[model samples]
Target chain A: MPGAETPIETIISMMVGRTLSNDALVIPDTASQPVALEVRNLNRGREIRDVSFAVRKGEILGFAGLMGAGRTEVARAIFGADRRESGDIFVHGQRVSISTPKDAVAAGIGYLSEDRKHFGLATGLDVRNNVALASLERFTSPIGVLDEAGMQREAVSYIRQLAIKTPSDTQEARLLSGGNQQKVVIAKWLLRDCDILIFDEPTRGIDVGAKSEIYKLLNALAAQGKAIIVISSELPEVLRLSHRIAVMCEGRLTGILPGGASQEEIMGLATLREPAMAVRHAS
Target chain B: MTDTTAPAPAAKTGPRISGAFHRLLAFSGLIALIVAFSLASPNFLQTQNILAILQATSVNGVLAIAATLVIITGGIDLSVGTLMTFCAVVAGVILTYWGLPLPVGILGAILAGAASGLVSGTIIAKLKVPPFIATLGMMLILKGLSLVISGTKPIYFNDTPGFNQIALGSFIGQIFPAVPLPNGVLVLFAVALIAAFVLSKTALGRYTFALGSNEEAVRLSGVNIDRWKIAVYSVTGAICGVAGLLIASRLNSAQPALGQGYELDAIAAVVIGGTSLSGGRGTVLGTLIGALIISVLANGLRILSVAQEWQTVVTGCIIILAVYADILRRRAL
Candidate 1:
């Protein structure tokens, strides 16, 4: 019975728990928006070779590629989670030097890594602590003592706002579902007030109901004018979410397509290898 | 659509209950040891013998506290024992050989310890050397340096007045005239209280657990993890400096060769106190109780005329049991 349901019906059922009139997915026109982040000729060994792109304000720029196509590498380079051989990153038209994740965060860039267990969540710590970790200075006194009550208050607020299904803020992060864990990561960046968010595999292991919730959350964040770059291997996810799509193959950005581009168009560019137009852009 | 069942929320009180359970288990074990020893030997319950056990625990307790900080960062400082000796020798050179003021000598020892710790931290953090190997190398280097600096001789604190009082004197007896607790026990309690506060209430303590729990995650959170790790090691070294002073003042001499095996005792105490050897979760109170447990076991067995070798065997058995208990607790979780 579930297999017979249409994709829209499933999403709708997951959203409201019942069927409703269809609302079209609006593709925001980001052409006139200011460029929030721009990378010029970013190079990182062989995995990322002279790759460049720009993400504008209020835009969901989806990165599409096959496995090992260097999409994650480019995200890491831009976020300064990895050493970049050479690159110029301009945030809001000002070039900022970011060599470490600390500098990247100081420059208002947040990276939600694909490896949630190792790089996104301190599973042994509680949800409140994890959410407050990136912004601990705000909850710390001049004498370096933590304001635990304040942290707990903020954590409870985020739990309610994000609909995180935890019994309490003190619940250990490892015990939470994958979707809730991802929300905790999102709450961390939100608390840090990061302007540029790079989400790698935002819904990789999440279930369908939680997956729809994440999609809604991402669209809401873009609606709030946050610059979001989503790197997902799922073509339908890219098609449904991105205002613009960037396709990569063999460490090169093969092409950029507008939102609503056909799956065949994305697949074609995903497998394209150093074509003349792609070569010209690299130079 | 059929796969939309909500994930079972974790038991609301699981971790909290288990944490309290572990501390209770350790505490009850300590109490059981005290009772058994008291029943087996009449002298074990005496006030003097009790004071002796507390005094014996002082140095190792302080050192174990130091290890707790580093271990919570998922690091091991094998150099803590020799580093303590190295600090004592530095104090000796300042107080006896150089004829410096007592305060200066004390400050010199602590600063020397901090500097050595800073070096160890830099090697591990900046050079990307693993913590175990770096500290192991530091352990040997410090042991050799202690012998070289002290000229293979014990450095006496005869030139420093009131030095022996630093550990042997009883400030509480001077106040109440009832309980004559040694200054060393007082120092242990003070150190434990301060360490507990730091671990619970300070940002440094937060990062210590975070680093152990998931270091890469902490780094990706935009934290300067290297700086924090280095700070943890430096603080640990400084605590070892305090331990050095306690031992030196207790004996009125810095015995260079007397420190090689002390590290094992300190680590044992930390493990028995319910602090995870793998890091992340630990407590200073647990360490203090752990140190007390070791001291009690040693003193009780000695009172009952157990051979020193058998005492060591018993200790080895306890350490294994404690670690196994921890593994079982984690598995239950």
Candidate 2:
């Protein structure tokens, strides 16, 4: 354990002593066993050196950083809504290429985008339809006829499962409150059997009571061994919810730390930029 | 400050009064027209005048019902007018030139309208063109096609001797000789009843409102919005086909020039009857009332010796007033 810090401490002390170039901090493997998702050497050929990380099953891996940190970009990349110039992504130890949101779903990956109102739901549909949308195949017959009764029964289960406060499944989504909308989004992914979940800015505008419920839901989902990755701007949220925390700065992974790590430690790594070191490599 | 909430008697009475007011307005409009027209001209009270009004409403009312479906989906079908005309021309071609059976001619006519609607729907849905642009293009296309097909002349349905009877004949009148209501009126009512039922009771109907209400929400819900949008246009098209049959039968000919302006009248009737052009809220009953209002106004104004140009101007003004009134009501809500 002491030996682990020796190299890092030596590097820091060397930089402090010589006031040398703020670069060449050797990085170590941050991923753990039973990898849920792994990105290895993503876009290594570009100006921005490709980095890698892994999320373990049943763990809340919180991603925290300041603005322009590429935290949301990483989440979007994994969700397949954004392109990775070159990277090998493995879901449940199986390498996969996801080019679109539909592909991500097919791989049992569910993404709750930051902008839930626009991308996550069809606001005009009733509660039941939004819940059943991603799983329409289960509700329709071979001949393309909708089984209304079957769909309704399944919807009732989700409404009960999510404890969605609505008169019935027929209540339109637009009529529901913000928290209810978030729950509906969760219910959609849950219905789709998505084991790997990416939640970005999960409680951005949700009220206090609803935020508590969402935290509880995330904990519950993690307890069930779902690979959960949360992207957040809130410090307390990242500190409290994560089992491990990953810090990003300037579109690069600055460092990874245990969840119990202090805000100062995370911020120190986030602001740890090696400007001349990157420039030195260029020369 | 202490009164957090209180239901005043007057506040509670408002909704009931409003409901009653609308019904009263429509019912009274119909009655007042009948009474006034009957008093002004003895000829107006005659069964012939009554039948004539009903007959006039049949075609426009049916088209309005079709337009109601499209408008409710937050879309419009401007081509419905020429599409109807094109359908009639097809029917005329089938009956008079191709020498097909009367039933076949009717079938051909309806299918022709539906096919055009399907094309418009495809252009709008699959091509990602807005409904206005797609349907506007379709309107012109159908107009040109009709004129070219008919060679800028009316095609008489003389070869199919019984074709005119489809509209002018009165089976219901024969059964109940006291009323003598034409079969065309009955057909119109039958179509309206069925359209209303489909809109209210079917999954397609619910989605129609859903599309107008929030199309993206519907798509996120995993509905094939393109397919549903196409279905709506196709249904509207099929109804247009029905309107074409009624019109051609009524005139005993397919007049290409007659359909170039009918869409405005149908749309006006729908709006006047209380259907919102923005979609999400509408009723077949409203379209019926709207159709009757236009017919009564025209019949009454003609009796009052209003010039034809003045009648057109009055109709235009009424459309604006009706739309403005709707805006006021929405703002009040």
Candidate 3:
């Protein structure tokens, strides 16, 4: 029982080597900032209801929900990775048509799927190729031949910038750890010049050290004016990183709260069943 | 926190070493087959016999390369043999039946292959059909079509003066005077070189491996996955066309019934070449070496008066051994 008396926050702080106070971080004020992504009544069968929300430039929008609350479904619908029954996605105040992930990327949106192995990283390919995968056309000549040297140079630079721990750019992605693999996925979106990024469970499988790094990286990316929506099941993580939190339950947006909203408040909204009650609580 | 969990550089070397080791094992196997054959019969290493082995490999080697492209994308092409026959029939119609020029016939056959491949790709990618089933259907369709087109008979290229020379004549022999390597082998080498280069240096090649590695990942990366998949299949079909021309030219006829069993051999060669059936990991060189192994085994066995049935048994055993070896290598890594 020696460590039983200690709080979870203290243990997390010890593991991450960082203070766990909300006061230590500066949350961005997005009231005056331009809206980077806005969705109007997004619907995708029974998985997602008429969900509408907006994230401003330089804002980290934390999506909070229970295990089956359809948070990932909403994100995938917005990113066009999954088909939506009815939805309108507006980027930079302009409505965009997105029928596929290709169209979403063309509209400057990137999605890092929660399952990295299945939907984010091509484990067999080397790091250089994965980093440049999203933006391959930039590295290709007019004749469709890839400029290998240019791709290598760009991959090496991203490896340095993202601090991806790999032996070389030529190292296959599967060999890297969870944290580094996440960084490689981040690097891919970054290299693609995607201004709007939806990261689903960004730190799901990462260790304490890499989780903090990813947190810092997300903060730094938001500071650079990237509109980020991080979908995480961990409430503390949502509270630690989000400027505003959006809570969902049973495919409906139960409520949206500020970053400093208490755990009890989020949990209340998370389990709220009635839409009428959610509207009252949201207001 | 410090990044203490990163794998050590030493740990990363395991796969690279084993990849090289696998290729080395395959190459040594090829060499061992040759040495064994030469020792068993003095006639096995003769220049004429070697040329005959190369000639036999030309058709299967080209088909295997085509299969390599598709297999690397985590897909299989079972229609390669019949598709080859179909293309040869197309070429026969152009040159022998229509009496068109030889260049036109050659171009026509290649284009025919590409078109069939496009159809297969569209079926697989757009219809969301599994590659195995899609290509299996294509195999039967093309087989029936080949028989129909050629009227269930061999379409002879006797009227086309240089048609037989495409595979039989040796351009290198013309220059070297002593080597006398057949043009079919030259074509095989040329196809291998181009396929290897495309797999290494082009966007298509990169996507091929990426699609096989994690197709959903590639699609999520904003790539047009269907387009690329279709393209891979189309290219595969075109390679099969080349194989068709080689087979037709070598025999001086388009034999519709001759191509049904060739796919098994091509796929066997691909497996023996260290290309994974599950997709995402393989090489053109590995496939080339594999094709050579098959022909060498077949030719060497015949030279030693081994029965054809037993030769097939040996080949079947070799395929299983090659795949098992691959599994061991992967598990070790």
User: Which candidate wins on DockQ?
Assistant: 3
Candidate 2, B57-155: lDDT as tens digits:
999999999999989888998988988999999998889988989989988987887788889989998998988999999999999999899899999
Off by over 4 Å in 3: A7-23, A275-283, B1-11
Model 1 chain A worst lDDT window (10 residues) = A15-24
- Cα RMSD of all models vs. native, in order, equals 3.3, 10.7, 2.9
How many Å off is the CA of B22 in candidate 1?
A: 1.6
Query: What would the per-residue lDDT of candidate 3 be over residues A1-283, giving only the tens digit for each residue?
Result: 4378998767866766665443345787778999999999999877899999999999999999999999999999988888999989999999999999999999999999999999999999999999998999898888779999999999999888878889899989999888899999999999999999999999998876677778888888999999999999999889988999999998999899998899999999999887676598789
A190-220 per-residue lDDT for model 1 (tens digits): 9999989999999988866677778888888
lDDT of 1 at B176: 78
Tens digit of per-residue lDDT, candidate 2, span A1-283: 3466576446544433422222222212234447787777665233224658888888888898887778878877766666777777898889988776667787888888787777776665677877877776676656455677877888888777767767678876765667777888888889889888999899987754555567767877887788899999998778767888899876778888987689899998777666876688678
TM-scores for every candidate against the unseen true structure: 0.95, 0.76, 0.96
Model 3 TM-score on a 0 to 1 scale: 0.96
Instruction: List, residue by residue over B1-333, the lDDT tens digit for candidate 1.
Output: 112333445555587778777777888989999999999999999999999999999999999999999988888989999999999999999999999888998898889888889999999999999999999999999999999999999999998888888899999989977899999999999989988898889999999999999999999999999999999899889988989999999999998887888889999988898888777989998889889999999999999999999989999999998888888987897
* Reference interface contacts recovered per candidate: 0.57, 0.15, 0.63
Report every candidate's CA lDDT.
0.90, 0.78, 0.92
Off by over 4 Å in 1: A1-23, A275-283, B1-12
Model 3 CA lDDT for position B284: 95
